[model samples]
Target: MSDFFLNIVEDEPQALSPEKVWKVAVIDDEESVHQATKLALANTHIMGRKLEFLNAYSAKDGLALLSAHSDIAVVLLDVVMETPEAGLGLAKAIRHDLRNFHTQIILRTGQPGYAPEESVITDYEVNDYKTKSELTRTKLFSAVYTAVRAYQNLTSLAAGREGLRKIIDSASTLFQERSIAKFSEGALEQINALFNINSDGIFCVSSAPKNPSPELAQYLTQHKHVDLSEVDNDFRVIATSTGYRDLFGVPLQQIPKKEVRQLINRALTTKSHVIEDHHIALYLDTPSTWQACIYLHSQQDITDKVDHEILKVFASNIALGLENTKFLTQLADTAYKDDVTSCYNRNGLMERAIPEVIDSNDHAVLYLLDIDYFHEITEALGFEYGNRVLNSFADKLKDAFPSDAMIARMHSDVFAVIVPGHGQPPIKRLIEHCSNQPLILENGDALRLGVTIGLSIHQEGTQADTTPESLIRHAEVALNKSKEQRRGSATTYDESLDAGSLERLNLLSELRRALSSNELELYVQPQVDISQQCKVVGMEVLLRWHHPILGNISPGVFVPLAERSGLAYELDLYVLRHSCSLVRQHPDLPPVSINLSAMSLDRGELLDDFASIMERFHITTKQISLEVTEGCLIKGNSALTNLQRLSDAGWDIHLDDFGSGYSSLNYLLRLPISTVKIDRLFILELKKTQHAATLLTGIIGIILNIGKRVVVEGIETQDQNDFVANAGAEVVQGFLHYRPVPFLSFVDEYKSH
Candidate 1:
């Protein structure tokens, strides 16, 4: 059966010139009608192309043919084909369902009553509607010719739009290339897209001259492109398309084709384009003494003057584009690279070097190094010596690491290096070498320095998308740990080291929500007068956070985080305003004391905000007392000035957490504080040993002798209370006297009394 089918296929006729024919589909139910149509248009030709008719017997066959051939230019349809309106239905399927809007449809019907011409043209989107009786040979020829012309225009517009889109996409890609070679290749691709041609080409660049302009010199210095001018001034192929790819990087004189070389030399000498019958060459000059040329080959002869003009414009633009790319490259280098150490700067390491290293290697380790006690060196010696030490250390880094390794100066006295794999032996050797060698200054002074190193390794076979920023941050965290535990040692990053940071971030976010949502409240713990039969002298206001998701966040955890995050100032303001409003509402309550953050003293506007809040609530400075830590007194003259302003404004100041940090007795005389609260640590130790009582007694006696009211805190036991009461403490604050309570509860218990 297969042999018989092959024999039948061999007997069929073949087209004379298939490539030069325009496809036309003829759909009808009668065989005679198909033969009649073909015979009538047998000698027909339009736009120098002959018609090749495709015959389909029924609507089903016609739809199948339309679906199989998307390039069909026109369709001639009979209205009644096995159904009353089969041809109209097929037209709708072609126009709507298949979305083949490019193909023109000409509907021909024998009976006008079956499907009206006006209805079919308007509803089915057919190009033309004609009755069979009116379609003679002359009219049929005109109808098909008109339809084919419309299809041609539609396809032409679509092709033009596609070409324009490709050009736009290529231009975007060309601007992102960093090197001349890459830029040349991108320009070649875009030029081919613009002309809708796939011809072969070659891009060549001549060497630049020595001692370029100052602008070019600055660019070259920043980008490290000075080596380009060192080579001999000869033209070399930088990029090529398809057949000419083997010519890349080859000198012009060594090219095998003498004719191509002669054409290139002619264009270079004249500094003008050479247009030929089947080829074109363009010459371009850059801002420097460098020149570039492009040679393109085509099969057809050059014609259209518009195309020639566009080619010239494109060439000029290519020259401008090259200069713009050079400027941008230099700008990027200056932004990210450090000129002093010839290493990547902080921006360069994060944006360029780190990404390249991660892309090329499977596993790598990042080392964060810092010069220990660098400030002391600068203070003792001069800044000149400090700079010399930094330069010497940078040299040591370059000598120790491989060429492919990324080295950068993160900031002052801090350098970072990224190496492959997770080994410790090389790092140990590097440290020993650095320690043994001392940097000798120009003044003949040898300075010995120590370094702290932190290492973070990205393991193999892990997630591929880990960012360099996160790795650097983790390494810095480890470096901080090294500095705290052992100043001159190295530590590797671990997941456990990130717990505190992660928790702090989560708590900060929750604290912000708490402040905005009114979840923060003040709890007051009363301070009793021990000599006045345990009378309630005053109440200390404490901050409390009630979070919806994490429940109550302890003041100990969130307060320090708030201070470090700079949110302590806002929290302090909130406490001040709310406490003052409460005291104003219930005048019978004792004087309230609120603790201020040490960070608030550094801010120049703290006093102003405090005064504004007090005036807004119609409360006086005497009604509220501010408690500041001992650390604030020794910060600077600014803190002292702020405190003196508060004291002059009739506000009472009390020293809080005394003797905890830098416990200098000088603060008692220097600060304008009316009361002192001994640190809880000293109060807890009063009953533990004999030295504790003697020390506590002596400290309380000294404060009383100085005429400053002393308040002993953290009295949990009766013995502790009795000792403090007899030891000359005017007031006591602890669980033994009263625990902290909410504002409403405190008002109900004490204010009603």
Candidate 2:
């Protein structure tokens, strides 16, 4: 059944012109009617064209044939096919369901009484109504002739309206296109639709000014023009349609066809339209003094004078679009290009070059290069000379790399490049060559520059999956490694090098979960006053996290991670609020010291947030001592203000890790600190050497003399404890007294003690 429907003849095999064959579907259940219809149309001619019959045995087959051939001009439908009203049903489906109003339907019936002619014509939009007896050869021919003519006119008008719509839509879109390559391609597409031809063509623009005209002055006010002074005079093809797509960016002289080249040259030289046999070239003079030409190939001749005029108008619009696109291109260049070196900037590298390299099929390598000791060089030489050196170095990089390579200035001293893989050898040689010749400044000063290069290769299959950002990150990791080894060195990234980064990321994710899930616990270690027979003075609050999978993570490991990830502020607040709540719950416990991160003091709101938490827990400020590192005090006036605000609120701000950092005594006087805790390193070394003991003793005396209490940490053995206690340390905290315990256990132990 399918084969029978597939073999339905919609065109005459022997017809000289298939376009002249009016496609007519003869739908009926009777095989005899099909044969009779074919025989009647065999010698028939309508509107000086032959009739092509399509056979359908039933209404189902008729609808299938109509679905297969959208170009069918007329349907000679039989009313009594497969059912009583099958023919009427198919006619309604074609007009209503398919929305195909163009194809003319003529209902023919053997039984005249089955369907009334007038009602069927009005309801189903049927073109003609006839009984088989009345549909004689001449009558049938007449009916088909009228229907085919109507279909032809309707299709022609639809085509014209669609063409005009495409032109208007294309013009609006072309004005918004910023890329020259994309704009030129879209212009070719619009031109093809405007001409109603699938012809091959090329869109080319003169690299420089052609015949400069005064008419271009009017357009300059409305559009930007490219500077032609730096451009060459050759005409380059920017876009091509279909068969000529490979000719894009090629010179006009490279075109193989002499006739086409001559047409383009003639159009460009005259600054007008050139029409020839089976070809046409329209030239547009842009405001930038550049000539834009579109050469089209079509077998159909341009006989209509109106069409030629429309083509001229289209050429003018294309010229304006090209001018607009040129302005957009200039703006993009300014945004993406570095002003100092004309290389791609960080924005360009990430937005344009990196994506292109990653999306390309070929394997590529990314090289991240940093000028070693660039800050020192900039300090030695003035900034003006430094900029000159950068520009000269950029020129050398451009010279070393291929045209396809993407080079960008990622930072003040760091440059990145993406090139084809296996480029390390050439890259190494280029660096060596650059080092041999020092960059000469404007004042004839020669400055030698050293660079460290890191390489990351992206191949089809590698264990370390590469994205645009990951590739650059991996290369930067390797670059740091190179800088650590020596100047003027190169290193390649390996999976092992990135393992730590991956682990850090995972740890950050887990730490966030731990905070939310109550996996983090507060442990307290008692601070004992050594001068009063080891009396418990206060307790230090410490944070501890036990992962469900990794068991336990040390504060030393995750604390720095939290600080770097900007999570330290939240962590410190959690510790502060939780420790205060514990003290509020147990009024008998001694004062507890809560350590705060340096980052917490960066914002002014810290003091307010701390006071709010203290009020919420009903804990007094003096009951909770705030301990911050010595480094926090040197962070600027903001930290000082936060500390002063806390101290003025009657909170004791103890300087933790006092001697760990520079230990600038100026901080002791400047900051509102009431006590100092000696760093563990100093306490551990107290009994090891006499110099350590003397240093500890002197630091303790200075704290006491300054009217501040002293707490020394990490006292394990009796000798070490005795050494610090005799050294005038008021309080000592270490395993020698007690280890950090859970809040409940610490409370129980404190009560017993």
Candidate 3:
């Protein structure tokens, strides 16, 4: 044996558990064999566990012994016993019948002829094969020690696999929690499952505590229970299996347990993990608002019982996950909370109220309040003053509604409230307060408010439409309906309000298809110069849609649809494309005026794109006239910028829809416009009212004084035509002279003339 144990020095024995022993079974036909095996292995030790031998002389006795003691680590068997294959039969029984796969079976033969075949060692559940003559003292010792050590390694591998499975399951549960409080509550249970430690745990956090009381915190922890008051303070026991949930507004050193405090402090100082004796203190890198620690009080020796490397990796992963979760939480606050008003924004309101409203199907009332003429207010005052007004408005709403009401700033100039329960909300009181009382600003300015409210009551049957977004929309529709009758009024949602919305949806879909198809046509209305004996001064191009199934669809129906559905830009491009094509065909036509929307004026192919299309059609600026409304005169707006570009390119600009918009006299002189068309509203007013001419005379004179031609529209009567003719408006356009004709038909008639 090469003197393997001649100078072996044994160290002091470990404080191991009594059950930690390597069990061995000695089975043979002879009594001398059992005595020899026992003497050889009596002093043997492997992996801190000494060999324990159980003896059975015959194969029958060995079978019984092996079956009874399943944990026996190794079996020494004689191949030739009372029967020729008796020892082999016992090996098969230990493997199949007893299902003792972990036990190592070593076969021995006294005679060379009795030695088992190589197949018996390879496939008959035998770990080793040896002859009795070769079984010296050293060989026997080496064999027993090696087999016991192999058994120990197999058990360790199985334990490690189980631990890894537990970690996977625990990590899955931990990763799903988004809030810090929720994550902390789950950590104890998950970690216990991960490490297989039967223990009580405490999760402490110092993050964002409210109304802290250090005295109460100390008393509660000492008493083994805490009320909600103690839980509201700092250094709180956020989660615990059994004991006080204290909250202390002090340092982490104020933790009640001395050993836990030491471990937590050590971990923080080293910026690493700390494990000791029967307790483990895991310091987590939480948000800047809080420092946290999970302290486990385990009864079993945990430090050396679990895998150290696996714990370190999971700890690192857990820290990374917490940091990520806190980051997302901050981002969520930014996304869902309004910065200017400190109210829940649209998304926040939806997330908070929708699910509850759906689940309860409770008697809930929704209120949408719009600040009437709010745009004009913002325009008159600066944007800074607008913010102050909004903040003051939000404060008044909070005062007006109940404390339990869920309120939010839905959008600019629009506020919402969701009141649950069957009580009548004090909405009338809120309106009167907003209207009669003056909102006092920060700089001691008192501004009178005009509030318009729309309400929707949701109950059991209406749960389908009780979604936050839908209810808010219904409330807004009612608010607009109220505004149509009066600026400051309240209205409740009705089923009739939905008819127009449904129609708009159907038309919007069809309009999208019309833009690409041949269903759209352009018509030109003649603007005649009165002084020149009704000579056509210019032609204004208007769009008309011809739906295949619906037959003539009016521009009034689809024009607003185009604007609302973001198809105005494309429709404007369609007009410009066809207008340039017309002037290309009929070169002798009067300057064709095509009305452009505010959106189209800014974003349409007016600058570079207009030039390119006109260049392609071989048309000049003199042949095309763009009609703009008062919206184009917003000084520094994109529409004005595009208008300046068109004027710079020598294209004639005409102010259309003049009296309908912000009809400022300043725009008449400041803008690069050559002609102005009075809206049809003034013409109808002139025929309906007594003093309408006075208004029309002054408006026409202003355009005339600016050296800009005035076109009086909707002059269907002879009296109306002569009235404008004498008023020196210069040009007049209406169905009385010529209804809008197709551009091609007008061109054909002009060519015939």
Each candidate: RMSD: 20.7, 20.2, 23.8
Clashing pairs in 1: none
Q: List the residue pairs that clash in candidate 2.
A: none
Q: For model 3, how does the per-residue alpha-carbon lDDT over 1-753 read when each residue is reduced to its tens digit?
A: 110000000121235575678888889988899898888777766656777888888899998898788788888998888988888888888777888777888889887856666666555658777888867775676667556644553343443456555654454466456565666666677777777778887776644322324643453344334453443234556567654355323346576668667776676556566777887778655323235567777878898765776665445445444544544455456566777897888877787665565466567888889897676566668778999999999988888877777778989899988877765556677789888899998898898889998987777765347667778888888887777667788998987877866787888989988887857999999888888878887899999988889999999888877876788878887898898987887788888888878767767466888788889899898888888888757523556768878898998988888879788887876778888889988888986777888888888887888788788889899888888877877788999888999988988877786
**Candidates' lDDT values, in order?**
0.77, 0.77, 0.73
Q: What's the TM-score of each model vs. the native?
A: 0.61, 0.59, 0.65
| Pick by lDDT: 2 or 3, better one | 2
The residue ranges of model 2 lying beyond 4 angstroms of the native Cα positions read 1-178, 185-306, 309-347, 355-364, 367-415, 419-455, 459-470, 476-492, 497-503, 618-620, 631-651
- Candidate 1 stretches with Cα past 4 Å from truth are 1-173, 176-179, 188-270, 274-281, 286-311, 338-347, 367-404, 408-416, 423-455, 463-465, 469-506, 548-550, 630-652, 669-674, 704-707, 725-727
So what's the TM-score on candidate 1?
Answer: 0.61
Spell out the clash pairs found in candidate 3.
234-248
Model 1 agreement with the true structure over 1-753: per-residue lDDT tens digits: 000000001111233453677889999888888898899899787656799999899999999999899989989998888888888899889988899877888888888655555765766667777788867775677667657655654564433344334443454467557667788888788777777766688998765534466766766655555565454447789899988989999998898998888888889889888878767778876535467888887776654421654565466557655554554455556767776677899888888877887777778888899988786666556677778778778877777677667889999899999876544346667776667677665566676778889988776577533578888998988897788678778888887778966876788898888887778999999999988988999999998887767888899888977886889899999899899889889887888999988788767998889999999999988789999998777655667888899899888999998878888888888779899999889977765788988988999999999989998888888888888878878699999989999987988988567
What TM-score does candidate 3 get on C-alpha atoms? 0.65
Please, what are the lDDT tens digits per residue for candidate 2 over residues 685-708?
A: 755788987888898999899998
- In model 3, the Cα lDDT at residue 252 comes to 62
